[model samples]
Target chain A: MPSLKNIAADLPPVQKTRRVFDGSFMVLLVLTLAGGVAVGVVSGWARVGQILIETFEFIAMLAPKIGAGIFIAATLPILLPRERVGRLIGRESGVRGLVVAAACGAALPGGPMMTFPLAAGLGVAGADLGAMVAFISGWSLLGLNRTLIWEFSFLPSDLVWTRYLLSLPMPVLLGLAARAVMQRRLA
Target chain B: MNILIGTVLIGSGAIWLWWQLPNDAWRSASYRASLDTFLFTAPRVIVALLGAGFFAELLPEDEVRQLLGAEAGIAGILLAIALGPLTPGGAFVSFAIGAAALKAGASPVAAIAYVTSWSLFSTTKIFAYELSFMGRQATLTRILVSLPVPFVIAAMASLTG
Candidate 1:
């Protein structure tokens, strides 16, 4: 129900081609290739083949969730814009603000590239340090997309559940701590 | 079981969010963004997952057990935390490595610490994204406040198990 504010039209257009094949991406590719080669050399080509085959299988299994995650990440901002986000969690929003910010962070999908900008935008729109901290902490600790799609896939169900449950309260606590720290500084 | 639940929940969320778009223009924008995100994310996921698989095979299982096994205690948690920020690549890379360590006899507490620390302070994310967007002071504040989280989470996790 929030609309975007401070849309920076002067911001340069994203270079789509460069984005997909940047230096980091190249490094990642090289590392994977090198790792595969080293493993093949040390463990045998058969093991490398098996691993590559398994990797494709895992990719196939993951395709649907990844698709869903992409959709949410794209569509979410439309529903919850900076103005609405800032209004609800502005600097003086207190405990309720922290809770809302944390929940938004947990529910908001995407990686750091997506999150950090949103946090900056929200800050300009009026979110305070506490809310900002809560939002980032929530995303880092309990992002639904990351936890459900990736974490569950790799870790055991019980361990994932244990960690997830214990972490549920952390973002708000951190937000509160950040607020208190800021207050002390001001006082 | 976890996969099924996750797929169902996320699927529903995506569908509902899709239906909520206000108009044709909004729908078009959303689609465009989704496509771009897919372009950016897919390759990274594929390459990172593959890298994780290869690295999993190479990990020294005996050494891991000696360092992070149940008997390793608090030291293992600290070591795991230290490794989290230093790891390169995406979330899957860290999670996959954590899983590999778990399979190689790493304690659950240690794994918890590793994942949490990575989530909070992955050096790559901090340097490449956070510092650039949020600026130095805010980033530093967030980091300082978050310093204790992984340790506390690991401690709580250890208590129940």
Candidate 2:
């Protein structure tokens, strides 16, 4: 297996510049408009306007938090750097490896486009299935960026905290579970 | 109150990261990147928030309560988990719907399960990205191992609550 640094270094830094108006945006636009129209038809235009006002007010409330979240998400990659994180996870093994992998997954910023590729590369970088599973699970369950920026913004804080705290140990447990199953197959 | 707490927490975090920028070049790059992200994110948030609001208004409280309320029990959580992967769009869509469901009387446990399920198994993330990047075997293995997560989390949350 290729070394983690070698594998990560081989992959070019993926600068995925998201289009402001993409397929997802178009879908959201249509859904929002359709929902608004339905509300108007079902209740009244007044209710639709009310919803619009409420949305904007919520946006205003969220602006500061969103601003902070964006800064953290953007700056995190620069601070941590890919090669260092890869090296850290790649060099370790057993539970320590899984812990490092989970930590990296949670701290690493970006969406699925960035994460999945990195995960695939880690697998090639000599990381085991346990580490790989832990990494993905951590990103999915405890990604700080998603939780702080999106989850907190949309969901109630109590619910967010409850879910987050509950999920804290899951990645490692899942990693161990994956390892056990794979080992059984080998045995 | 929640927003205030979140703002303070994230605000301090941002400030700390800014302090860690190390030099002028990095600061500029961070600013440019943040601006780009803001441009990318703002419109989506606005639209998704609107959709969420409208959908919240449209959700029949009676049905939501019947389907996913505290009274709905384990079946409600199962339904929530099932709805997660089927929901189209991104993080905001699932979160918005989850919030809407909560307003319409869905149990907190069900909401947690829905969000957890969506985070782990979003079809767009899976079929579009994970399957292509991680290949079928890795993806399938990950899915199989993770199949019980939402249910498990929901049960844990219920127990704690």
Candidate 3:
């Protein structure tokens, strides 16, 4: 078993207040509110109420998984610190780097909020552009948690499997392509 | 059934991670971080889901069927790919919309194309997160290299199914 990297204990505790209502959240809120109003106008206020009620019921059903996901997202970063992951990934080149980068991206359980920062940090830690692209692509296409928690819930099992299998090679292929493009520019 | 399986797997993983925390201080800090994340994520999930539900209700089923059904073929796949980047919000929003579209008689190929396209090129993800973090040059490179993925996946999927 990998020793739980206890390095988080050594760092000074952060006291930053994370705002719940940022520009992204506001965008989503406005879109939802607008959609709700449209439903009221086109269908009826009763339909809007029913939709709201149903959405809440769906949320209730999803709460446990969401809680678990949030925990993994928060704790994983601490346990597997960015510097360590960057060191592990940054030194590699060619296919090996792409594979490692993709593996990290797929295995890491978090949303974009966590991933983009990690990718940026990886770059600063000496990862090449190709590896970074692979990392982001891997997370976008094959993130285990998102597939398990959300995709399986929404899409049919066969469809999900097909997509997953097809996507298994994408990150590496994209990484190679990114490298090729970068080389072409230099040439 | 899917939800149950997912919840159990993720729940166990969460427990294992919690057990791995070294001591009381680390555990407490982890707890605080998780709570903060939950606070940030929950509202977005709620709003995104609500928007998905409302938008699903508004979908013109007849037009969807005409455009994306089995007979619609390559054109439908192209249309689905085109619509992917335009979708706003998070993963759930795209998945929910995909589900609703499938219910409305869209073909499986179109749905796969749509989901794949959105995953790679969603404007929301690009504009809000990727650009700010990854820088414009890297972001453009990723997007450029990934531009053909959905089409390739869709093509292969159609061949098999």
TM-score of chain B of 3: 0.94
lDDT of each: 0.85, 0.84, 0.89
Q: Pairing residues by index, what is the TM-score of model 1?
A: 0.91
Q: For all the predictions, what are the DockQ values?
A: 0.59, 0.57, 0.72
Q: Give a tens-digit lDDT track for model 2, residues B63-158.
A: 999999999998899999999998877787888899999988999999999999998899978987899998887788888889998999999999
Tens-place lDDT digits, model 1, residues A79-114: 665456666656547788888889888888877877
Clashing pairs in 3: none
In model 1, how large is the Cα lDDT of residue A107? 81
Highest TM-score, which number?
3
Model 2 / residue B48 / CA error / Å? 1.0
For candidate 2, what is the DockQ? Answer: 0.57
Rank the candidate models, highest DockQ first: 3, 1, 2
Task: Evaluate model 2: give its lDDT.
Answer: 0.84
Spell out the clash pairs found in candidate 1: none
Top lDDT: which candidate number? 3
Per-residue lDDT of A16-51 in model 3, one digit per residue for the tens?
448898887788889888999999999999999999
In order of appearance, the predictions have TM-scores of: 0.91, 0.91, 0.95
Flag regions of model 1 displaced more than 4 Å. A1-18
